[model samples]
Target: MIKIVEVESNKDLKSFIDFPHELYKSDPNYVPALYMSEKHLLTKHPFHHHSEMSLFLAYKNGKIAGRIAAILNVNYNTFHKDSVGFFGFFESTNDFNVAEKLFEVAEKWLKAKKAVKIIGPVNPSTNESCGYLVEGKNEPPVVMMPYNQPYYHDLFLKMGFHKNTDLLAYLIDVGSFQDKSVKMLDLLSQRLSKRGIIVRKVNLKYFKKEIAECMTVYNEAWDKNLGFVPMTDEEFEQMANDAKMILDPDFCLVAEYEGKAIGFTLCIPDINQIQIKMKKGRLFPFGIFKLLLGRKKIKKLRVLALGVKEEYRRVGIEAVLYGTLLKNAREKGIVEAEASWILEENQMMNRALENLNGHMYKRYRIVEKAIL
Candidate 1:
């Protein structure tokens, strides 16, 4: 019998967290997320303030078949007023029956909440990890990104899901991108300097204070995005603390207007390049040694997030951010980087990247289906 059980105990919760590891154990491209970190994300992350979610596991013939989470964000509905629900943390054996049963559980839970539309594979929400990894299947994901079996796409399509949005990931070889874009950047930046706009690496001494300024701009910058949810001070602080561990000050750049922060770009070394090699996703005993030793050898990065406050959207801040990123990459010996999860509709950011000669090497999509 295939039975779906709500996670009601510690043992069941552990199984839910460990399911993906077991399912992807044989896949070399699969990277295990840090156990402690995922636990907190699902359990104690401050996102719970505006959202409610529940977890479920599918068992078939006494074997773990799949897992999923049903999510309802009161804030999301109120903002867009779309009555949309989300399903995330999804994983399953390569079986149509198993996937249907898992998705049914998510659908049922959403229906109970009066959600009229269902969307995602969005771990919990877009404010965190979101999307189904539909392309670039040959390698593991960047740090804090999602990855899954290629066949999973067919599973969702069969389950009546269709594309709600697509996110693009751009790849740029550091030495090559800098070489190609440098001259134009140099010329343009000089133009920008004459207008009093300056590009520079972040100052660490007042990092926290700067983050506060950026936070105000962040909410304004992305306010027009689909499913956009502004972060609370607590949530931003927590996320910043986590990023501080691996955040390269050089790779995080800001654009100033008369000494005020108008835009920022942040990237981090793709630590998953090392994390996946660790196999078990631990940072102890041998894992810590591997992480420390492997950091320098890994040469890829992810341009994680970027924003230009609404008042300063056009003009040339994006190029300034990219130019500053170029300087950082040259200094750090980074060979390549991925600027990702760009919404297909975000033509503004897309044009900025293309102008820098970034190629859309990978694509991911969020799918949706209506139950009624």
Candidate 2:
């Protein structure tokens, strides 16, 4: 018989976090999440301060068969003025019965909370890693992106879920990328300079101040995105601290006009290349060395975030930032970079990446179902 159990104790929570590691063990492209980071996210992240989430695991014949988190994002509902709960941190075996039971329990919990609709695979929220890999299963995910077995898509469909939207991941070949924007990098910079706008690498000396400014741009820049909820200051700070550890200042750039920050882009090395080698995603005994020693050798990157103030759009700042980032990556011997989770309908950003010869190699879906 299949049983669904709420993750209430420390032991059960550990199982919930570790389930994916075991489920994807035989999959060559699987990259395990860092255990410590995952623990913090589940137990004490700032997200818990404003939202509610309950984790559940499916047990079949005394073994973990699946796991899911039912979330009621108060902030999301408050911001969007809608009644939608979320199901996230989902994983399962190839058993349709197990998947259905897991979601049944999660949906019941959200329904009791008075949620009218359920949407996700959001890993708790849109501001974090989300979406299920529905396409491009041939390769591993880049840093901070989600990946799942091909069967997860089937599970969602069979369980009455429908695609709400698609998020796109673009793979850019740095060595061969040729675009007018790249060729005009210098000319663009000179022109922007004449307008008192300058694009420059982030100043690590003033990291805190720099991040604070970037946070402002981020909140404003992404306000219009689908399902976007402005991150609280605490949430933004917590995220910034985590990124700071792996940040290469050269890959972080800010565009300023007359000393006021107007736009920025942040990229980080694809540490998944190193993390994939970690056993159980543990950072102790050996994983730390792999991370620290392997960072410089990583030649892949992910453009985690790039945004500009609404008023700054179409000012050539976006092109300048992309061109500069590519130039930096090429100089560092970076072979590939992925600018991802771009909303599929964002033609302006999509077109910009295409102009740079970026190929949309991966597509992720956010699926939803009615609960009320």
> Which predicted model would earn the best TM-score?
2
Question: lDDT value for candidate 2?
Answer: 0.91
Per-candidate Cα lDDT values, in order, are 0.84, 0.91
169-275: candidate 1 lDDT, tens digit per residue: 99887787644346577777887788788878778789898788778877888888767888788777777778878887888888888998888888888889888
Q: What is the lDDT of residue 156 in candidate 2?
A: 90
TM-score between model 2 and native: 0.98
Per-model TM against the reference: 0.95, 0.98
lDDT of 2 by residue, 116-207 (tens): 99999998898899999888848778889998888888889888899999999999999888877788999999988998999999998898
- Could you tell me which residue pairs clash in candidate 2? none
> Model 1 Cα displacement at 128 (Å)?
1.9
For lDDT, the strongest prediction is 2
Name model 2 segments beyond 4 Å from true.
none
Q: How far is candidate 2 from the true structure (C-alpha RMSD, Å)?
A: 1.0
